[model samples]
Target: MFIPAIMAGGAGTRLWPLSRKEFPKQFLNLTSDQSMLQQTLARLEGTGHSNPILLASEKHRFLVAEQLRLSNVATSQIVLEPFGRNTAPAIAIATFMAASESPDNILLVLSADHNVADVAGFQKAILKAQALAENDYLVTFGIVPDTPETGYGYIKCGDPIDDNGQRVSAFVEKPDLATAQRYLDDGKHLWNSGMFMFKANVFLEELKKYQPDVFDYCQSAFNNMQSDHDFHRIPEDIFEKCPDISVDYAVMEQTASAAVVSLDVGWSDIGSWDALSKVLQKDENGNNLRGDAIALNTKNTLIFSENRLISTIGVQDLVIVETKDAVLVSHKDHVQDVKEVVSTLRKNDRNEADSHRQVYRPWGHYDSIDNGKRYQVKRIFVEPGAKLSVQMHHHRSEHWVVVSGTANVYCNGEKKLLTENQSVYIPIGAIHSLENPGKIPLEVIEVQSGSYLGEDDIERFEDRYGRVD
Candidate 1:
């Protein structure tokens, strides 16, 4: 049996407008009905592994918790990094956590946002790698490449090993078109998939030997960890000192007992629009159309619309994605340059670089429907048994009309229960709170009229999420 640790912290810049810094690709439902994170959790089933230990950024704590609750995964062992220090420190922290359980337990490391079409093949490869891990080998699953793809690094395989695996002859960086073609022709190279397996203690020792400073910093941060809600947060100042490097550089490249298992599982990282288009199902014209899109004379294109109907005419080799706040139109060949748009947006202090029009909170979510010079409208959802903080706004007054279920409104130390079609007014500077006391979800339409309608105008008195003292 092995323990799984899923790394979920990443900024998917190429998939912007749909994926943001606040909400990345892992939390998106790109392929199926479930999100990639939920699918990763489901991938653990039938493998006889323990519940996964999720590692994410501190800002993504609620997202991690909500995904776990939605998937019915009973794992509360989430480790939150202050900020991303790359994979080495993250895996080091996970290794230390897993070692606390048992040093001999194998830890299978996986990314939370990878798409694998062949689930059975992936499980089989995991079993193969676990056998090598049992023999003190640092095993990484290498994807058998079908095409001369230059986006990924290649791994050259040596002689066969004991567990249907091969010794890793060398790990090569991303190659040019000619080198990639040569590697494909030689048939001795595999794409580095970044999935690894080894005993918890064995990985810790390898990390300590090669990257000693990183090892020391991660161990110190882990010793100073704090348990908050359903997550474990490493201290910010200490974790920041950990080197910003990947596990491939810190341990895998320097390890002596490295092994590679050939896996042909139809895997894709979904890194870019072109990569995502290749992984998704396509029509006869080689087009993948999602969500209220109508295409005419379109071929080799991808159109994704999140809100309204998007009709395209005479488009080829293109990607057109429409979100509530922004839209991205680009040629498929230049999809990798989309990150330049995100960089420009960030330089201009644009909120679109970080968030969507709809924002999620610990309680529920709210969508901004309309906004004018002095008035803004929001469609708010409050989950059952969830409550907003007791706070007062200095510059805005809110009018809330309950559209569904029930609401308990507390304003200025007075409480009132409101049902469907009922309304309540919260004047400016009135200490107020809202809660859903019923078993069903409560929906409300809130209209705010104020000189300043920004989100930073509230002073909290009491909060359940530890946002305030």
Candidate 2:
């Protein structure tokens, strides 16, 4: 049986203003109502595959589990990484874990942030790769290059290894525009999709051959890993010492067992706004827009407006993204350089580099709709039967006015059932917890007034979601 290893820890900064470090693009509902990660999970259905193992960062552990829960995936398949060490370490750790169940099982490694339009074509390619993987070849899915796309690395096919698979001659880095055009004209290169299928033991053999140090590091870390409910907690100290490297550099580039399968599916990594625009349908004016937007004379532009109405009078070949906390407007050609914006924000210690006005917790989400000096107004939503941590703030006091549903409020040592329009005060140093006691979501307007209204003021004493840290 095949086991999927979903990699979901990328920060995806280039697609920012909507995608942030705290909650990346994979979790966002990019193509439809479901998130990219959820789509990835759903694609595995009816494939006769075992439960997937989700490899994600510590910050996203709960998020990953929650997404899988929404997709109705089994709970035992989630793995948590304390820190990101990229694909090599993650794959190594994952293979080690999979081997514990069965050494001969094939692992299909898929990135969570990708978009595949044709699931049948994808399944065809995966089945072809599975055939090669069963024969001990480490197989990678290579998308048939439609154009001179310099954003992705290319795989030069050497010769036919199987009836449907090709021996990988070499992995080429992102080429120049001219070279990429030549590659497209030659019809011998394919875009590296970063998706692979291999026997767990074959991958481990390659790790031992090409990257023994990484193999040893991950093996030791996995051996020492502890179970945290449904999550597998990687030994932080040991896992952190593992080399920060991608699977391409650490194994596939050096291993002789590498093979590539040509995939004709419409696949996209959705790395930048331009790439996302390509997947979305365009309007009469050639504009791809979401949320509340009005484009008067826009052509070949992607506009994503949230929390407000965005009007574009005469924009062309541009990407305009608006969130509650930040806005990004850039030329479509310069979409790759959007990472520089995140870098500048990081240098200036701006929170926009990390999160948006709406922050998603394990329970639900909170949106800072409006704020002022010494006062901030937030709309908080708690999922049914969910509760925030029992915590106390040292400097700030909060007033929670229930807007809908019912809330169980714990302020100081007093507990009260607060329904719609009921308000409660949580003064400074008073331990409080907010719970959704109703079937629907409990919505409230939280107003804070204090000298310090920073998020760090909270001292959590008890948390049901295991977020004591």
Candidate 3:
């Protein structure tokens, strides 16, 4: 049996303003009603594998768990990386864990941020690749080049090993425009899809052979791994010592057992706005307008409006994305440079570079509605049976008015059960928490007044989701 190992912890900078460090493209509903991660889980149906081993960021544990819960995938295993050590270390860690259970079990590595339209085609490819992997061949799916895409690396097929498998000849880096066109014309080159399948022990052996330090460090890190509820946490100090590198650089390029399976399944990495446009439904003018967007004489344009109505007049070949906090207007031709803007934001220490207006928490979520010099307003949602940490903030006093459902408020040696339209006040430095006791969701409008209103003010004494470190 093969276990799906999903890599979901990427800071998608190219699709920025929409994709942030805190909530990346994998969790966002960019292409369909289901998010990219959910679509990936859905793609696994009928493949005889329902549960997946999830590799996610430490901060995104709640998001991953909640999404998986909603997706009805009950048997997922989440390994939280303290920080990204790139794909090499992440995959190594996963391999060690899977090998512990059964060395011969196959691992189907997938990127949670990728979109695959043809589920049947994708499943068929997985089975075909499984046959090669079972023969101890390290398999990588090579996407049949439909376009001359310079954004992706190319893999040239060597000689056919069988009817379904080919020996990977060359792992080529992203080429120039001319080189990309030539590769497309040659037909031997395929887009490196970054998906792979291999036996867990076989992957570890190849990794140890090519990158011994990575294998050793990850081995030690996995040996010292700790579990928190449904999540597995790695030792930060030891894990950080591992060299940060991509799997292609660490293993695929160096391994002699590397094999290629040319896949024609409709897949998109959604790395840029232009790539996302291909998956979306476009109108006759070649425009994909989502969420209250009106276009006049617009062609080959994609407009995504979140919480606002956007109108484009006589615009052609443009990509405009509007969010609650930031709006990105870029010509689709130069969307690749969006990462430059993200880099500048990181240099400036801007919050928009990492988070959105609506912030998710284990309890539920909170949307920052407004803020001033000394005050902030937020709409908070608490899931049923979920509670915020028993905590205190030194800098801010909060007054919450219940908008819907019911709330169980605990403050400073007292607990009060509050219903809809009721209110409560939490003074600065008061130990308090909010809980949803009803069957439905609990919504509250929280107004903060104090010298400082920041997320760091919370001092947790008790937390169910393990924030009490």
Candidate 4:
């Protein structure tokens, strides 16, 4: 049986403004209506695969589960990492979990944030890798490089092991432009796709030989794991003490059993804004415009407006993206440097580096509409039958006015039902919880007045979704 282990922990910083720390690009629908993570799961449909095992960060556990549920992909196990410890520990934990299914079960490792246009080709490649994996080779699918892409790392291919496999020579880091061109000209280099297939025991053996310390730490973590529903929580104290390193740096690059299988499926990692623009459809004038937008004389440009209209008269080879709180406008060639812009925002302690106006939670989401020194306004949307944690704030009082559906409100030990246009007030230090009692989503405008209005002021006493202290 093939157990797909989807890795969904990277915070894609290059696609900022639209992608944030709390919500990353993997959860964003970069192509079509489905998100990249959802697309990753959909790619495995009817491939004779079972429920997948997900390895994601604690911060994104709910989002991962929600997305998978929406995609109709029931996960077998959801392993939660206390912190981002890179792929070595992440894969180790996943490997240990896969072992419970069977000692010789094959794990098909895939990143949650990539797009592959040809799902059939991907499945075909997986079949080939599975055949090799059954023979104990640690096989990774390498994309046949279509261009001299300096952004992606390359894999040097050695002599053919069989008619369909080649021994991996070395994993090369991102090269300079000239070297990338040289790599393309050499005819022996392939882009490191990072997708792999390995027997559970084979991967564990390689880990033990190449990275014994990481193997030992993850072994201990797996032994101490606790399960809640479909979620598997790794022991935070010991897992946090594990080394922070990528899998390539820890074992894949050092193991002699590594093998590469060539894949020509249409693929993109979407590492930058420029990369995303390429995957989208363009107009007759070579422009990809999203949201409320009008353009004239634009050529090969990408413009996105989240909350307002964007008009461009003569923009060419540019990217103009706008959100409720931040806007990004840059030339296509310069989009890769957007990470430096994020660094600048971090240095200045800007909120744009972390989130947008809308904040997602386990139950629902809230979008800040207006704010001031002593008062703030937000539009909250609670999903049907969902409830917020029973909590109180130290310095803030809130007035909630229901806009749609029905709300079950708990305030100061009193429970009340509120319908459309009705309102309720929870005074400072009063425990409150809001629930969606109707079959549809409950929307409300929350107005807050307080000396301090930060989110950290909340004291949660009862929460269905287990959160950090």
Listed per model in order, the count of residue pairs whose N, CA or C atoms clash below 3 Å is: 0, 0, 0, 0
Error of 1 at 329 (Å): 1.1
Q: Could you tell me the TM-score of candidate 2?
A: 0.97
Query: TM-score of predicted model 3?
Result: 0.98
Please give, for residues 68-101, the per-residue lDDT of candidate 2 as tens digits: 8899888586778888898999998889888999
Local distance difference test, candidate 3: 0.92
| lDDT ranking of the models | 1, 3, 2, 4
lDDT of 4 by residue, 1-469 (tens): 6999999988888898888888999999888899989999998988888678898888898999899889987775998888889888999999998897687989999999998988999888888888889999999889998789998899999989886689999999999999999999998999998888999999999899988889999999999998888899899988987888888888889899999999888899988888888888889988888899999888999998888999989779999999899999999989988889999999999988988899989899999999999999999999998999999999999999999999999998899999999999999999999999889999999999999999899899888887635
Model 3: clashing residue pairs?
A: none
Model 1 segments beyond 4 Å from truth? none
Worst 10 residues of 1 by lDDT: 9-18
The TM-score of predicted model 1 comes to 0.97
Clashes of 1: 0
lDDT of 3 by residue, 21-55 (tens): 99999999998889889999988988887368999
In order of appearance, the predictions have TM-scores of: 0.97, 0.97, 0.98, 0.98
What C-alpha lDDT values do all the predictions have?
Answer: 0.93, 0.91, 0.92, 0.90
Top candidate, metric TM-score = 3
